[model samples]
Target chain A: MSYEDEINQDILNSKKLPEKLEISVLRYFWQSNPLIGKKTDSIPRFLRKIDVLSNFSENELRILAKYLHLRKFQPGEVIFKQGELGVGFYLLYNGYADIIVENTEGTDEVKPSSKHILTLEKSDYFGELALLQEISIRNASAVSRQGCELLGLFKPDLEELINHYPVIAAKLLQSISLIVANRLFSLTREVQELKYKLSSYEKDQDASN
Target chain B: MPQISINTKRERFKLIFFISTLLLAFIGLAAMPRVSIPLLLGYVIFLIVYPAVPTLEKLGINRVGSIWIVFSALIFFSIYPFVKVVPTVTAEIENVQYFLPKIEKYVTKKYEELRIEVREKTSFEIGDKYFFQALDWIRKTSTNILLNIPKILASLLEWIFFIPLIIFFLLKDGKKFKRGILKLTPNSIFERFYFLSHQFNKKLGDYIFAKFVEASIVGITITSGLLILNVRFALLFGLIAAITNIIPYVGPVIGFIPGLLFSLAEYGPGTTLGAVIMLFVVANAIDIAIVFPILVSKVVDLHPLTVVVSVILGSQWLGMVGMIISIPFAAALKLIAQEVYKEIYQE
Candidate 1:
């Protein structure tokens, strides 16, 4: 028999309920769901680094795993185009992804080439800010460097989850607060350096004159 | 292929009508005088059983074992509290009953003096009819509630047996129940309803968890304050406040009644009056200034007036149960309304 026929036969044989089912039948039905991919569990390590699911309990994590959709990307396939509506977060399970930004080569010295601003490795996750905060298009495009597996958790699910689990919502808020605070600190440092550089440039100009 | 098909509007409207009809039937049953006791008992039983799923899951026990563990835990949680407090409180209640007539006499005398004063000052007539009418109304209401005692007892006994059994089956076959529900749906509306239900479940779970935490905080604070004041039945009174804290605007009023009665019984009217006033102010201050703003922020997006109006309307329609569920029900309605508006009217 062909593989499809064999699989169909297997399903028929398995149709009879087992003498004693161990898990919640719901878990069994979910486990059999075709939407959940073989490597869905692999994505959790990467997603754990994202603030959203970091502190979720095992049951909560499992619920999240079921909710997330698995999407695969071949090399050079854009995970998300830069200027599209962002709906979900992507977790890189097994391949490299590059975050590309379109900008002149230098801030002052303009050039034609756009930059690969950042490259992310395995266990890296992105697209969260857009999903979490309902921002417009992503700031950069993430292209898979090779064949990759990713789990996409949509925005609406997250909001619903947060509403149901206020603790999780509270934690998400806390995480956002931390991210904003970190950005503020970095911006402050960058501003101070820029001020110093501008003052030095003014001194050089005065000396030249 | 999408594992769960996204059904079209035709399929969804059918399911929506079906679910809405079922819910309306439940509400009707809940509102009926005869069936209200059983319906409440059944609902509470389901609630007790439902929480067992997680409690068992958390313990890393198998589903059957988890059900047993949860069953045992609930029995302990409920029975233990009553065991510790009920006897003492019952004895106190008996004492209060004996003194009730004397206290009423004193209150009437004081009221008579105030009535004479008011009669002299204003064009007000002091009539026993008004007082007797008020007393008669209270008696009637109390009797109505007491008449349901047998039904309530039957429900309690039924719950004692039925909760565990329902919980076991729920934990065991809940997935099947859900899947069966899903399978019955026409493919057209499956996806949207599935997604919406998922969204609703998550929101509900979070709302309950947050409310539990918030109520606990309020309960503990009130209890501690009452304990410090050496108030009678501090734990019980604290619990009353905490439960009342569930309802917005009206919770503090419910909390204050028991506190006032306890104060009156323990101390005379003059001395206890100060304590009663302080209890209301403090308990309410905590709820308003601290507990509410922190616990349930943005969960119910209705304006203050809207919330007040909804509560009153809900109370009128379904009494206390309506009051308990009104906010969340209103919130769900608001959510569905917004979604429908955006779907139908938005460009």
Candidate 2:
């Protein structure tokens, strides 16, 4: 058989490339017809699943993806701690994260200071306030619940993105702001419902007495 | 056990192949300077003008138009000042060289006398050996640079003739090339490759841009300041200050020496003192107050000691260009190390 045919046969036999054919074949494939206008196809499959990036088009994402960084963490790793200055935001690509708020009401020693307030699975993002505010002090802590991968977007990169791709930058900032607003509105509604229940409970007690 | 062994073997294979590929490419480039030098120069120019391309696209300009506009503006600004300044700089450089002997003599005499006086009275001997050693180093560096000028000029001319086309192609195809590389990355470390390269590009590119801005500010301010003071060789001093300002710790010292020497020899200690005070104020104040705060703040979070060491090693190994690039390379390495370490140890 010819070399090409032999290579094909080898590929078919084990579904694993022969050692010599492997390196050469991959090289040949990689070097083949590199071109212009390569789109955001390289936006990692993991990042594409994130809610914040979900709304972005492939082209738009390609631009934003250029500014992001990737990081990995093990189970029990503290991503950020409460009261610490938040420098950037993270999109959890895989695994689980726990958003923890520490109770500051008790004495410094002897009291439970930390509790898991929220569980953030894949696509959930946090620390976004760092993007919008001049100073961002973390209200809660984030700890990896498992071996996790994350895509990080920082303040400096945002600034650069604004300068370099203003339209994309504007749309992204708008999306982030909308997410924050929705969260706030939900929290406000919950507070109002709790207040109404408390008042009704007081009236009930008065009537019974 | 079998799976782990297989994964390890595959990784080792990938490592060998990747390293070999890099080595081959580097060797090929070194082996063929004529083709490679122009490509290298073009890549550099492409990097410098790349950010503007995206901005122009956002502003609704086409690729060709964007490239033209950016390059035209750069060439114009660069060439105009270069034409006007070159003549004056060359003349002043001649004058500086003529006065070098006197400057050396004065410095040596003063240094020796001070050393003797200290040894005689204080029972402690001051060493002048290091001073001469440094002077020798400087002399060797300048002479080597001067010697290489003609060869450099020839290569630059070749690059200038070929660079525009190379840059055009790079701008057109760079994204595709990056995507191709990214697409080839395995899922296991795809994120690692993607983020590390982005960080490298951002930090290194920003650092370079900041240096250019710092140099320009230093140059223009010195030129205007000296002209106002009616000092001789104002343009030359300004140019010198600008070039050396890019060098970190030793740069300001190098920039100040010639101006002080000239002023002391020609005008007297009164003017020399003024010159000294001016250099101190301008170099420190402008660098600290304006340049760092505005153009360069936190671009590369390298310690000062890292910078000094990088410069020394770079100069020793690769001379002028190496010295300029050393800091950025060091910063890039630091960034990769931090990320990789976090990945490894955090587990």
Candidate 3:
């Protein structure tokens, strides 16, 4: 018999009513009910999709979720401005954000021109340096592209987490450190590639001369 | 772009709404002292006791279980003081009023004797106007406070009911309340506001906790010392010392004055009086040498002038509660000021 048919057949063949049937019924209502039950599990499920947070267990993610502050931003609202002091690391929960850096070398005008660095979608995180630095200045501004939701873990929250859950704090710090290391590695490789290109261009100029 | 300007306008509106809501809440709290007083007291107590919940949780108890344990212990300890100390303190305060006349008589007699001696030696007549006026002022204020005791207790009774309930809820859902407030905070100022508030709260908590321990040590030392010496109104005097110790710099002297006057009038210039003097000196010495340095000074980190100014400002604004809260309030203001300074100049 097919799996669904066999389960149905077993239920039909059972002579005595199943024990704890009332509890099973109540639990079904509790879990499947639209209003209350699923909300608590949603944050942990969201955290599970984050690449950096993948190492955190289901329980750890739940604990981490308690420390997060969910913030909503309207379209075109500034998340943070460049050169401003920051103390939060945030993950985009929904919608999109654009990272923009001002071109300081541009001619003085009424407003300094800002260049778009990148757009971040769901599950993307930024401002990890703020969590670790003593005095962190935002290197780039992030503005919501079309209204977004963010889950922010701040310095104060991190401090409390460290005090209450050292293991989880350590895991979080490790993840943040991994992100920083990866970014630094790629940046160094890009600089090396540029250096090689510069030398090759110089040699070609010398040959042409 | 028009979009950016519209967003800016909307953000500004949100910020204004957030600020006005805060102001309205403040006004509401001020309008009703009955609820606010207990809430303020509960918040202070919560700040002091809330750390224990985490400590209990670290021992493997669940969060709710840990909160229950800490709260029950708080209630258990408070009950004894409520039961035993209240009546004795009330009785002592009542008895103190009757004893004040004897102290006044002794002081005037001493002044008369001193006046006679000074006239005989230097031929300069000393006026008793300022001295008598001062004496009258002290007597009137002491009597006024003693008379107000019943009224104070009526409110204290209300606090006894409300504070615990408030504290219980705060312990259980304090984070939820905080998150709720955070949700209301405008996004433009969210991170700055959050960091400043958290820092201020931590500073306030540490300062209050330190002051509490310091006051208790002083109170217990003086009370037990007086009891050992067979002094009258030991509890009353100790309680005064403890309450006044919440103020900085001048507090110890203010606390000592009542005991000094009472000891002189009650026991005269003899061994008992000398011992009383010694007790006040030792208790304050311990506070200055040990407790102040170890507990208080670190938490406040304000200049002495700043402390004095804030205390004056605080007393002018809200009397005793203002004085008690002044240092932390000043510290918070300084933190905000520093942040603003950095933004304006350092950046």
Scored by lDDT, model 3 comes in at 0.90
Q: Per-prediction DockQ, in order?
A: 0.03, 0.07, 0.33
Candidate that beats the other on lDDT, 2 or 3, i.e. the better one: 3
User: Please, what are the lDDT tens digits per residue for candidate 2 over residues B270-345?
Assistant: 9555865576576668797877777776787788899999999978755665577778878878987887787577
lDDT per residue (tens digit) for residues B1-347 in model 1 = 00111234554676677678658877787657455544444444444356555554545666677766766776788788668765665455445455545545655677788889989999698887888677667556655655665675566666567555655566567656765665554433343455565566555555665666777877888788778878766776777788887778878788778667657745766755686568668767876778667767645667787778878887887777667667766777777787678657743
TM-score of only chain B in every candidate structure: 0.77, 0.79, 0.93
Over 4 Å off, model 2: A1-209, B1-16, B19-47, B101-152, B162-166
User: Which segments of model 1 are wrong by more than 4 Å?
Assistant: A1-209, B1-68, B86-96, B120-125, B139-154, B233-236, B261-266, B269-272
Could you tell me which residue pairs clash in candidate 1? A164-B202, A164-B203, A164-B205, A164-B206, A165-B206, B7-B188, B7-B189, B8-B188
**Model 3 segments beyond 4 Å from truth?**
A1-40, A105-112, A198-209, B1-6
TM-score of each: 0.57, 0.59, 0.88
Instruction: Output the worst ten-in-a-row residue range by lDDT, candidate 2 chain B.
Output: B1-10
Residue range with the least summed lDDT across 10 consecutive positions in model 1 chain B: B1-10
In the predicted model 2, the residue pairs found to clash are none
